[model samples]
Each structure stands twice: as structure tokens, then as C-alpha cells.
Target chain A: MDLFAERGYAEVTVAEIAERAGLTKRTFFNHFTDKREVLFAGAKDFEDSVAKHLAEADDDLEPIEAALLALTEAGLALAQYGDYARARQELIASSTELRERNLIKMASLAVSIAEALVRRGVPPGRASLTAQAAVAVFTDAYAAWTERGATADFWNLMQQSLADLRRAVDAAPSRPSGA
Target chain B: MDLFAERGYAEVTVAEIAERAGLTKRTFFNHFTDKREVLFAGAKDFEDSVAKHLAEADDDLEPIEAALLALTEAGLALAQYGDYARARQELIASSTELRERNLIKMASLAVSIAEALVRRGVPPGRASLTAQAAVAVFTDAYAAWTERGATADFWNLMQQSLADLRRAVDAAPSRPSGA
Candidate 1:
């Protein structure tokens, strides 16, 4: 990441990265397909953990609660990644292509979660909606935790985000009364 | 979109589109920057319309409400696109590069909405959160509306989505006591 931050993602060469870490190019390839994978390396593991939680959840739990349980549990673990997480975030934020890729990754995750919900007998539309909304709350809360230096538990921060959204909606200025 | 979808986004060459439509490639260039733009022709216009709405919204409205108002208005206007919308969506769905571009376009729009909130004195972090949450809600609701043969009002569907999220979060399964 230091190498990336210093040299920019586009300018940094794979060979340079390999040599900088005292590794052969073959060794680097054994670990990652490309530089982008360095920042996204954990996404697959994260997704699997979330999926496992979702699968193990009580079948009767509300879809949102079940998904939130999975996400909060997953987020709690991810929160431990700490500065490494933020640096990855910084790298993503610095590049347009990465930013786009990041959103697609999130979109793809939401789809996977939604598919899991659907397979669990959740209604198709509701599953989709809950999946997207869950991702939204999780991402927002995760950003909060990262930017604020981990002052709060991940689940608690998620609660605050849900709380904030409620406040925003309820406090919405009155629409036309007679419309 | 019909021409592109009938073929594939990449397979349908620009010259073929112009020739089949009895126009010169020059005319196509005059409109779209490239093939993908044909799929996203309305997105820029939609964003501009939303920006206009935000600019006109009551200055005292909360950022979330202001964003909803703008997006709701745009969504209604977008409902007019109909089957062209379906074909365009299918084309983008079929192409990874196009999908990434679309997500970036959506992210750019969210940033624009966030900027409007920032200008209205919303805290930068809060503005970003609100904007992201709003986009999530909007995207979900739009998906709901478009999944079937939707021909009615758009704002109403948005209102339904807002209600759904509020209910889901507020009714979230309570945490186990003393956990």
C-alpha cells in the first residue's frame, strides 16, 4: 500500500512490487492476480463469512434481521482489519476505475446476499430490497467506524446509522397537506 | 437500444446502427460519444433534472428529504422511457465494462446529490451518508417498479420503498437481552 500510495496505482509495476517485497514475480502471481486484488483480497473471504452466518441463522428470523445479523457479525470481524482497511479504502477512493469496481463489487455482494435470502424462502422482491438496504447501512456504518478511528462497536455504529436514517425520514419537512 | 440489444453492445457496430437507421455515422457521433451512451441517453438528462429539483427545493428541507424529492421527480420522468429502458438495461447487464461504467455514472450522480446537500450546510460525512442511503433506496425502489409492467406514477413507488425500509429497520428483531 505504501508503494501504491507513493507511486500511484497506474504507475506501479508488478515487477517493482515483487522486488520491493523481496519476492519473485512468480511468487507475487501465486498470491494475487493483479494489483487491484491487493486491496480487494479479503472480499471473497468476507462474502463467505457473511454467507455462512446467513445460512446458520434461525430460519424464522425476519429477513432484515437475519441479514443484519450476518452483516453485523461480518462487520465486527472486518472492523478489526483497522488501518489496513482504511488504506485499502484510500486506494479505492483515489482511482476512478477502482471506485467503479468497488461499487460493482458491492452490487455483486448484494446480489449474492439477495439470492441467499430468496433461497431461504424470502419473497423475491423483498429479498432484493432488504439486500440492497442492508448493504447501504453496512457500508455507511463501516465508513463511519473507519473515519472516526473505531470509537464504537461495529454493531452499535450500524444501529446509529439506522437511527440516523429514521431521524432523517421522520424529520422530513411536511409535504403538501392537501395534495 | 433495439438495434444494439438485437445484436450485442459490442457486436452492433456504429456504422451498422447508422446505416440501418438511414443516417450517417456523423449523425450518430453528433449525439452519442459511443455505443454505451445510447444505453444511457437518459441518465445525464435525469441527473440534470434532479439537480434542478434540488436547486429549487426549499432551503430548509433536510438533505434526505431534498434528495428524495429530486430523485422522485426524476424517477417519474424516467418512467416514460419504458421498453427502451428495458432493452437498454439488458444491454448494460450483458456487458461487464458497461455495467462498471453504469455504476460509476450512478456514483457520480450520488456525488452530485451529496454536493448539493453539502452546499445546503449538511456536514460532509453526513451528506455523503444521506446521499448514499438515498441512492440505495432509490435504486431498490426503481428496481421494484421496473420489475413488472409498471406504467403508473413513479413517486408513489418511491414512497412505498421509503415506508418499506423504515418498517424493516424499525421492526428489526430486538437484540437478545444481556447478550
Candidate 2:
């Protein structure tokens, strides 16, 4: 976020980033294809862990439960990166390019969730819808948990958000047609 | 979309866009502050229609009903631009910068919904949650409706998606303790 605020994403060179990190240019490339990647660095690991956890979860659990379980488990992993997460969030907020990259990463992960379901025998259309909804729940939970500060555990907050999603979707009666 | 794909957002130059539209650059600037606005050209009017429709909507309607009603009504406004909408989607997908711009627009609209509800006397947190949920429903339904060739009307698909969300949420016979 500092680099962006100081010089803008378009203007900052990868070499400058490497020099600042006290790392060689080759080392930087070895870690990330470009500076923009620092924003999305750990997403794949999150996705993989979520998928792995869900695969081992009980089959009787509904897709939403299964998804939330995965999200909670992923949140546990991110617990060590609280400050890093905040900084990354700021970086995404700082640039339009980064935000788009973040969305695409999210959309792609949602697709992965859907595909995982399909491989496990979920209907394709249902898979897509369920996956999207799960992603929605996870996203809402993550956002709520991220900014909740020191009083909350990320995993616990995610669980609450999942519960909130349940109440919002189920307990609230569907709106009448006119409204 | 054509203009953007051909010349890129920054390189397109607003003056050239004005000429293409047979208007002066001054008129273009009067309409938008920058090139990104052109890509989201329809968003403002769409939001206006939604806000207006939502404001006049029956209070008794459930949240899903309220969301679908607004989406369906807005979808009609966008129907004529089906091809254009698809093109815009493509452009946004192809460019991270444009996608982030789109997310900010979405975030703004979500906040607008929350504010509108707060004015209507709903509690702040509930209003925000409901607004975010509404956006999520529209996003999933719109993606389904558009990606599948617009076979179903926008509102109908939204209703289906809402049902799908309900089922997804309720499918879990029981949530875990942490959940």
C-alpha cells in the first residue's frame, strides 16, 4: 500500500521492489511473477486447503456446511497473517488493477469449488449455484472477520458470518413479488 | 467494448471517444470524469431505477422479493443492451483495471442500498447485510442468466437463484458447534 500510495502501481518497477526487499531481481521473480502478485500471494494455498478439508469432510453435511467448514479451516490458516492480511487488503483498495485481480481470483476459486462438487457427483447447474453461494458466504464472513480487530478470532467470526448467512437466507421469509 | 478492446482504456483518449460519438470532448467530460466511466456507462441510470423502484416497493415484501424486484426491473432496462452488456463483461474480464473499477461501483451500490434501507428505518447492520446479500443474489443470477444466452428473464432467474440459496443454506441438517 505504501509503494502504491507513494508512486502508483503503474509507475513502480519490479526492480525497485526487489531492491527495497533486499533481495536480488532473480529471487523476486522466483517468488512472484510480478509485484502485483504480492496482493494475491496466498490465495491458492487457501483454496487448496479448503478443497482438501471439504473432500475429507462428512458427506451428509449440506453443501453450505461443507463450504463453511472449509472456510473456517482456511481462516485458521490465515490467523498468523493478521497484519499482512490488513496490508494486502489496503493494497487491493489502493489500485483498480489489484481489485480486479482479486475479483478474478475469487471468481476462479468459486469455480474450483463448483468443479470439486461436480467431481463428487453434484449436478452442474446446482454446482455452479451452490459454489457461487458458498463463495458469497465465505466472502461476507471474511470481510466481517477481517475488520473486527483484536477482540475476535478470524475462524470464530467466519463461523458467525456463516450462521448469519443461514438466518438471512432461511429465517427471513422470501419477499413478496411486489417488493 | 470495441473501443476499449481496440485502443485500451488509457490510450483511447476521451477526445477520440467524443468524436466517435459525434460529440465534443467537453460534453464527454461533462458526462464523466474519466475513461473508466464510459465502460460503466449504464450503472448510474440502472442504480437510479433500482433506488426509485425499491423506494416505492411494498414494505411487506421479503428481502429476496425486494432484491429480485429491483433486479428484474433493472434487467429490463439492460435487455436492449444484451450484446453490449456481454461485450462490456468481456472487456471487464480481459482487463483487471476495469474489473476493480466495477467492484468499486458494486461496493458503492451496496452501500447505497444499505443507506436507503437505514433511511426507511431498518437497523444499520441488518441493512448492510441485506444489501450485500441482495448484491450477491443479483450477481449469481445475472451471471447465470447472461452466461446461458439470456434464455430466462432476469427476474425469474433471480427468483430461482434465491430459492437455490435457501436450499443451499438449509441443506445442512445441522451445523457444527463452531459453525
Candidate 3:
């Protein structure tokens, strides 16, 4: 990330990154298949942990509640990497390809969470809608948190965003008088 | 779309499309910069119509409700193109590049709706969160409608999805007894 910040993502090469990190090219390849993966190496773990946490929520917990629990768990897991995450986001925002990759990554996480919810006995449609909504809110909140230089606790931001989501829904136009 | 369905998207050329449409290549270029643009030609109109309706919705309507009205209006505007829409979706699904383009397009629409909501006096945070959640549900509902061969009215699907979104939020774990 430091190299990416100094030299720009497009200008950097894997060999240089490996050398800068004091690791051999072979060792670097052993970890990430490509240079871009270096920045996203933790994403797979993030998805898995969130799914696990969501599935462990009480059986009676609603889909959205389970999703929030999962997101809070994952946010805590990622809290220590705030600076790194912020820098990585900057690098991604610099390139269209990176942005596409990041979008796909987040989409996959939403799908995984939905599937996890389904496995916990939520109806497929409800699970999917809840998961997508939760992920959308969580992603927005995370961005807001990072934009604030990560001073706010990620869980707090997630909860606030969740409330905002509910408030928005609650504000939907009321039904007209019966037909 | 027929050409794409018959020969596959990557196998078709702009010249062939122009010729099949009884238009000169120059005329085709005047309308669309590329073959992909032909499939997405209405997207700008979609954004404009939705924004217009959203801004016109009752001032008291919440950000999400306004967005829903806009979406329903836009969906109605595009309702006549069900077969074409489904075909275009199939073509897009066949290619990673197309899928990425579609995702970016949807993201931009969400951003535009959020901006419109802000212009209508919604706070920035609420506007963006509402816009995103609305888009997520709308996209899923549209997909479901298309999957069912468009037998269900798009507006109905939107309403059902909105209700599901509300249910999901309502089910969110109640705040623990006292903070």
C-alpha cells in the first residue's frame, strides 16, 4: 500500500512489491495470484467469518438481525486494519478495473450472506432481500466511517446506518383509503 | 437482440447490426457509440424519467417512497419492452464486461437518485442510504419479474419487494431492553 500510494497503482509491478516487502517473487506468488489480490487478500476471510457469525446467531433472530450481527462481527475483525483499508480503497478508486473488482467482491459477499441466511431456515426471497439490504447499508456505513478517517467505531456506524434504513422505509407513503 | 440471440454478443459486429436494422453504419454510430450502447440506449432515459418522477413526488414523501414512485413510473415507461429487456439481460449475462457495465450503470443511477433526493431536502446520508436500498430491492424485483417472463406487472413486483424490505427491517432485533 505504501508503494501504491507513492508510485500509484498502475505504475507498480509485483516484482517491485515483492522486493520492497523483503519477500521473494516466488513467496509472493504463493500468497496472491496477482498484484491486485495483494490488496484484497483478506476479503475471502472477511466473507467467511461474517457467514459463520451470521449462521451462529440465535435461530429465532430475524434475517436482518442475523445479518447485522454478522456485519458487526466482520467489522470488528477488520477494525484493526482501518488505515490499510483506507489506503487500499484509495488505490481502488484510482482505477476502473479495481473498482469493478471491488464491486464484484462486495456482490459476492452479499450473495454469501444471503445463502447463509437461507441455510438458517429463512425463506430464499426474504433472505436475499434482507442480505442485500444489509450489505448495502453496511457498505455505505463503512465508506462513511473510512471517509471520517475511521475515528468512529465501525459497529456504531453500521447500527446508525441500519436505523437510517429503517427510518427511510418507515417513511414510505401511507396507503390511500380502502378501495 | 435477435442477432445477439442467434449469433452470440461477441460474435456479432456493429456493421451487421446496422445493416440488419436498415440503417447505414454512419447512422448507427450517430445513435450509439458501440454495439453495447445499443442494448443500453434507454438507460439515460430511465435515469431521467426516474429522477423527474422522484422529484415530483409529494414533498412529504420520504426519500425511499419518492424513489419507489420514481422507479414504478420508470418501470411503467419501459414496460412495453419486456421481451427486449429480457433478451438484453441475457446478452449481458453472457459476458463479464457487460455485467460490469450494467453494475456500474445501476450504481450511477443510485447515485443520481440520491442526489435528487438531497435536492428535495433529504439529508445527504439519508438520501444515499435510501437510494441504495431502493435500488437493491428494485433490481432484485426486476430480475424476478423478468425471470417469470414478465407475467407479473413490474409495479407489483416493486411494491412486493418494498414490503419485503420493510419486513426485513422490522424484524431487526429490537434494541436490547435499555440501550
Candidate 4:
């Protein structure tokens, strides 16, 4: 991240990155398929952890509750890497390729969460809706967190964002009037 | 659309596409920046239309309602090209490049809608949350509409999906009980 931030993502090579970290090229390749993976490799583990958390959530919890719990926990874990997260966001914003990859990663995360909800016995349609909305909340909170330089408590931001979402939905008619 | 469906998107070239349409390569280039643009050129128009509809929506409508009204109207217009839309979706699904493009397009549409909401006196945060949720509802409805071979009324599907979103959010606790 430091190397990419300093030299720009495109200019930085995997060998330089490996040398910076005092690792062999083979060792770096062992961990990441390529330079891009250095930024996004955590996404797969995050997805797995979210699913695992949801699976272990109390049976009585609502689908959104379970999903949010998992996300909030995962988000808090990410919060520990504030500087790295900010740098990662910058790197993603700097490159179209990285931005698209980040988008796909977030989309896949939502799908994984939705499938987890389905496995928890929620209907597919409802699960998808819940998962998408939950992910939106997470995304909104994350933006706020990063924009504040990651100083805010991620959990509180998640709560506030969820409340805002509820208000946003409630403010609108369930069906358009006279429809 | 037929050309793409018969031959893969990558396999089909601009020259062939122009020839199939009885147009010169120059004329095709005049309209599209590249072959991928052929599949996505309407997105810009669609985004503009959604913003226009939101801008013109009745003042009494909530942010979500305004956004949804815009999406439903634009979606209904696309419903006329059901077969084309299905083929477009399949072509996108078949290729990573197209899928990524589609993802970026949808994300941009959401951003456009959020900007429209902001113009209508919504706070930026609330506007973003509403826009993202509304887009999610639109996506769910579009998937269902396409899955059923587009035989369903797009407007009805939009309404049903919005209602499902409401129920899914309602089913979840506003905040976790112990939090």
C-alpha cells in the first residue's frame, strides 16, 4: 500500500512490492495472484467470515439483524486497519480497473450474505432484499468512516446508517399513492 | 442483438456489426465509441430520463417514491424491448468485461438518482441511502422480469419488489436488541 500510494498503483511492480516487504517474488505470488490481489485478497476472507458469523447468529434474530451483526463485526475488524483502509480506498479510487474490481467484490459479498440468509431459512426473495439493503447500509457507513479518516466508531456509523435507511424507506409510501 | 446472441460478444466485431446493420463502419463509429458501447449506449439516456422524471415528480412524494417513480417509468419504457433486454443480459452474463461494465453502469445510475434526490431537497446522506435501496429494488424486479422471460408487467414487478423491500426491512430489527 505504501509503495502503491507513493509511486501510483500502475507504476508499482510486484517485484518491487516483494522487495519492499523483504519477501521473495515466489512468496508474494504464493499469497496473491497479482498486484491487484494485494488490495482485494482480503475480500474473500471477509465474505467467508460474514457468512460464518451469520450462520452462527442466534436463530431468533431477524434476517437483517443477523446480517447486520455479521457485517458490523466484520466492519469493526476492518476498522483496526484505518490507515491501510484509507490508502486502499485511495488506490481503488485512482484506477478504473481497481474501482471495477472493488465493485464486483462488494457485489459478490452481498450475494454471499444473501445466500447465508437463505441458508438460515429466509425465502430467497426476502433474503436478497435484506442482504442488498444491509450491504447498502454497510457501504454508506464505510464511506462515512473513511471520509472521516476512519476516526468514527464503525459500529455506531452502521447503526446510524441503518436508522437512516429505515427512515428513508418509511418516508416513502409502501406503494405509490393512487397506484 | 441477434448477431450477438448467435456469435459471442467478443467474437462479434464492429465491422461485422456495422455490416449486419447495413451501416458503414464510420457511421457505427459515429454513434458508438466501441463495440461494448453498442450494448450500453442507452444507459446514458436511461440515466438522464430517470433524473428528469425525479426532477419532475410531485413535491409531496418522498425521496424513495420519487426515485421509484422515475425508475418504474424508465423501466416500463425498456419493457418494450424485452427480447433485446434478455439478450443483452445474457451477453453481459457470458463475459466478465460486460458484467463489470454493467455493474459500473448501474452504480452510476444510482449515483445519478442520488444527485437527483439531492436536487429535490433531500440531504446527501439520505439521498444516497434512498437511491441505493431504490436501485436494489429495481435490480431485483429486473431479475425477476427477465427470469420469467419478461412476460410479467414491468410496472407490477417494480411495485411487488418495492413492497418486498419494505417487508424485508420491516422484518429486521431497526437495531440489534443488545447493541
Candidate 5:
């Protein structure tokens, strides 16, 4: 990350990244398919954790509630990496390639959550809608948490963001024509 | 699009695209930066139209309502090109590069709508949340419309998707611990 931050993401080579960490290119390739994967190393684990959490959620929970609970639980695990998260976001914001990768990661995460919701007996359409909205809440809360550095309460931010989302949706006109 | 559909997006070159349209490579570059841009040619115009619609929306509309109204109005204009839209979506889904570009375009649209909402007196946080939710609604509605082919009513789909979003959000637990 420091190498990419200093020399720009595109300019930094896999060999250099490997060398900086006192490893060979072959060893680096063993762990990551490409340089971009370095920035998204934990994405699979994060998705898995969220899925596991959702699967274990109580059967009585609403689709949206189950999805949010899973996401919040999974997201809170990242609280220890607040500074790294902020720096990673800045790096991503600076590079189109990284930003695109980040977006794809988020989209995949939403899809996984939606599928998990479906497994919990939620209908497909409602599961998809709930998962998408829950992911939005997570994204906003994560952004706020990273912006505030390591000490911010991610749990509080997630709750506040969810409240804001509910209020915004509630404010929408019941009939489109009425707007 | 035909060339991309038949030969794959990466395999199709600017020269071939221009030749297929009976134009020279220079002419193709004059209109688009690359082959990928050919698939996204009207993105700028679509964003501009959404912004224009939002700017002209009634002041009484809530932030989410105004954003949705703008997106739906702009989206309806593409009802004429439903077949084309479906083909474009298929090509995008098949190509990682195209999917990334599509995601970036949607993200930019959300940011633009959020800025428009902020200009209309909504707080920044609320504007951001509203815009993201509105975009999610637009995305699902657009997908359903295209899935049902050219005859589907884009406006009605947008309305249905928005209602689904509202119902899903309403289903979320009011307190984090309630679940």
C-alpha cells in the first residue's frame, strides 16, 4: 500500500510489491492473482462471514433486519483497520481501476447477501430489495466510520445511517403522480 | 453493438467498428474515445437529462421523490430503445470491462443526483442516502423492464420498484438490538 501510494497504483509492479515485502514474485502470485487483488484481499472472507451470519440469524427476523444484522456484524470486524481502510479508500478514489474493482466487490457482496436472505425463506424480489438497501446502509456507515478515523463507533454509525435511510424512504410520495 | 455481440467486445476494434458503420477510424475516434465508449455513447446526455428534470421538479417533492421523479422521467425516454438496451446489458454482463464501466456510470449518476438534491436544500448526508436508494430503485426497475422486453412500461416498473424499496425499508427493525 505504501508503495502504491508513493509511486501510484499503475506504476507499481507486482515484482516491486513482492520485493518490498521481502518475498519473491512467485510467492506473491501464490497469494494473489494480480496486483489489484492485493487491495481486495479480504473480500471473499468478508462475504463469507456475512453469509454465515445471515444463515444463523433468527427465523423470525424480517428480511431486511436479517440482512442488516449480518452486514453490521461482519462490518464491525473491520473496526481494527480504520486507518488502513481510510488510506485504502483514498487510494481507490485516486485510481479508476481500483474504484471499479471496489464497486464490483460491493456489488458482489450485495448479491451474496441477497442470496443468503433468500435461503432464510425471504421471497426473491423482497430479498433482493432488502439486501440492496442494507448494503447501501453499510456503505454509508463504513464511509463515515473511516472518515472519522479509528475511534468512531461503527455500530452507532450503522444505526444512524439505517435511520436516515428509513426516514428518506418514508418521505417519498406514496403515489408517483402525487410528486 | 452487433459486432460486439457476434465477436466479443475485446475482440472488436475501433477500426472494425468504424468500418461496420461505414466510417473511418478517425471518425470513430471523433465520436468515442474507444470501443467501450460506443456502448456508453449517450451516458452523458442521460445524466444531463436527469439533472435537468430534478432541477425543474416541484419544490414540495421530498429528496427521494424528486430524485426518483427525475430518474423515471429520463428513463422513460429510452422506452423506444428497449431492444437495444437489453442487448447492451447482455454484452455488459458478459464482459468484466463493460460491467465495470456500467457500475462507474451508475455511481456517477448517483453522485450527480445527490449534488442536485443538496442544491435543492436537502442536507448532504440525506441527499447522499436518497440518491443511492433512488439509484438502486432505478437499477432494479430498469432491469425488470429490459427483462420483460420492449413492451414493459418503464414508468410502472419504476413505481413498483420504489414501492418494494419502501416496504423493504419499513420491514427493518427500528432498533439494532430488536432483531
Candidate 6:
């Protein structure tokens, strides 16, 4: 994270990242395909954890509720990496490629959440919307937490963001034409 | 679209795309930077149209309502190209690069919507959430519309999707644990 921050992500080579970690280049290659992969290494784990939580959620929970429970769990899990996440956010903001990768990762997580909802017996359309809405709430909470720094509790942010999403949706206006 | 659908986005060349359009390679270059850019040529226009509609929405409308209006307009505009959209969707579904581009485009539109909301005097956090929720509705509606083809009215799908989102949010349960 320091290497990417001090030097631009584009300017930082794999050798340098490996050197900074006191690992041999060959060892680094064994772990990650590229320097960019290092920053995103936790993405799959995060997605899986959220999916697992959703899958294990109570049967009585609504699909969105189950997804939110997963999100809260994911937020708590990510709290330990607040500094790293914020640093990575700076790098992602600076690089279009990294931003695309991050968005794609989030999009993939939404699909996973939707699939999990389907497994929980949600109809496809409802599953999809609930998943997308859940992901949206998670993204906003994560962003707010990162922006506010480590002092903020991610779980609180996640909960509050979900509540805010509910209020926003509830307050939504009917179509202008009233059709 | 045919070239991409048949041969894959990675395999298709700009020359082939140009030839398919009955135009010279030079003419294609004059219009688009590359084959990928051709697929996303309308993205900016879509963003602008949505932002414009949102900005022009009635002052009495809620932020989410304003966003829905813009989405309604955008959906109506996109409905005219259902065949082209679905074909492009298939090509995008098959390719990581195209999918990333599509997600990035949607993400960019989200930012544009939030900015428009802010310009209309909404607070930043509210603007961001409203924008994301609106996009979630649009995405679900678009997917349903594409699947149902021309048989479904885009407006109705969008309305139904927003209603579904509201219900999903309203049904969201509180965090599972006190933590």
C-alpha cells in the first residue's frame, strides 16, 4: 500500500512490491499473478464470506435482510483492514484500470449475492433487486467508512447505510406521469 | 455486434467492425477510438440525458423520485433498440472486458446522477444513495426488459422494479446481532 501510494500504481513494479515485502520475486509470483492482484487478493474472500453469511441466514429473513446480515458481517470483517482499504481506495481513485477492476469485483459480488438469494428460494427478479440493493448499501457504507477513517465502526456504518437506503426507497416518488 | 457475438470481443478487429458497417477503417477511426469504444459510444449520451432529466425534475420531487424520472426517460429511450441492446448484452455476457466496460459505464452514470442531485441542492450522502438505488432499479428493469424482449414496456418494468425495491427495503430486518 505504501509503495503504491508513494509511487503511482502504474509506476510501481512487481519486483519493487516484492522487495518491499522482503520476499523474493519468485515467491511473489507464487502468491500473486501481478502487483494489481495483491491489492485485490482479499476480494474473493470478502465475496465468499458475504455469500456464506447469506446462505446461513435464518429462513424467516427477507432476501434483502439476509443480504444485509451478510453485509454487516462483511463490514465487521473488513474493519481490521480500514487503513489498507483507504489506501487502496486512493490508488483505485487514481487509476482507471484499478477503478474498473474494483467496480467489476463489486458487480461480481452482487451476482453472487443474487445467486445466494435464489438458493434461498427468492424468485429471480426479487433476488436480483435485493442483491443489487444490498450491494449498493454495502458500497456506500464502505465508502463512508473509508472516508471517515478508522475511528468509525464499519458495522454501524453498514447498518445506518441500509436504513438510509430504506428511507430513500420509501420516499421515492411515483412516476411523474402517474402511470 | 454480430462480429463480437460470433467471434468474441477479443477476437474481433476494428477493421472487421468498419467493414461490417460498410465504411472504411479511416472513417471508423474518425468516429471511435477503437472497437471497444464503438460499443460504448452512446454511454456519454446516456449519462448526459439522465443527468439532464434529473436536473430538470420538479423541485417538489424527492431525490429518488427525480432519479426515477430520469431512469424512466432513459429506459424509454433505450427501449427502441431492444434487439441491439440484447445482442450487445449477449456479447458483453461472454467477455470480461466488455462486462467491465459496461459496469464502469453504469458506475460512471451513478456518479453523474449523484452530481446532478448535489447540484440540485441535495446533501452528498443522500445524493449518492439515491443515485445508487435508482441505478439498481434501472439495472433490474433493464435485465427484465431484455429477457422479456419487446413484449414488455420498459416504463412498466422500471415502475415494477422500483416498487419491488421499495418492498425489499421495507422488509429488511435489523442486524442479526447487537454487535
* Residue range A1-179, candidate 6, lDDT tens digits: 77777889899888888888898889999998765678789899999998998889889987887888887786687777778878888889999878888888888898999999999999887787788888888888778878887677766777788888877777744654733
Off by over 4 Å in 6: A13-35, A172-179, B14-35, B172-178
lDDT of each: 0.76, 0.71, 0.81, 0.85, 0.86, 0.82
Q: Interface Cα RMSD per model, in Å?
A: 3.9, 4.0, 4.5, 3.2, 3.6, 2.6
Which is the leading candidate under TM-score?
5
Which portions of model 4 miss their true places by more than 4 Å? A10-35, A172-179, B10-35, B171-179
Which digits, one per residue and each the tens of the lDDT, describe model 5 over residues A24-120? Answer: 9999999998778899999999999999999999888888778878888888888778788889988998998788889988888989998998888
lDDT score for residue B74 of model 4: 76
Question: What would you estimate as the lDDT of candidate 6?
Answer: 0.82
Q: Which DockQ values do the candidates obtain, in the order shown?
A: 0.37, 0.35, 0.42, 0.50, 0.57, 0.58
Model 1 docking grade = acceptable
Q: What are the per-residue Cα lDDT tens digits for candidate 1 across A1-179?
A: 88898988888888888999999888999999766666787788888888888988888788877887788887777756788888877788889768877888788888888888998997777787778777877888888788887666777777777666555555544473111
Candidate 3 Cα misplacement greater than 4 A, ranges: A10-38, A172-179, B7-38, B172-179
When sorted by DockQ, best at the front, the candidate numbers are 6, 5, 4, 3, 1, 2
Candidate 2 stretches with Cα past 4 Å from truth are A1-15, A23-34, A90-97, A150-155, A171-179, B2-36, B90-101, B147-151, B173-179
Candidate 5 C-alpha error for residue A95, in Å: 1.6
Alpha-carbon error at B29 in model 3, in Å?
A: 9.4
Model 1, stretches more than 4 Å misplaced?
Answer: A13-35, A58-61, A119-121, A150-152, A171-179, B10-38, B59-63, B121-126, B144-150, B176-179
For DockQ, the strongest prediction is 6
Give the TM-score (0 to 1) of chain B in model 2: 0.82
Candidate 3 lDDT, A49-71, residue by residue in tens: 99988877878777887788788
- Say which prediction, candidate 5 or candidate 6, comes out ahead on lDDT: 5
Task: Please compute the TM-score of chain B alone for each predicted structure, in the order given.
Answer: 0.81, 0.82, 0.85, 0.85, 0.89, 0.86
For model 4, state the Cα shift of residue B25 in Å.
Answer: 9.4
Best by lDDT: 5
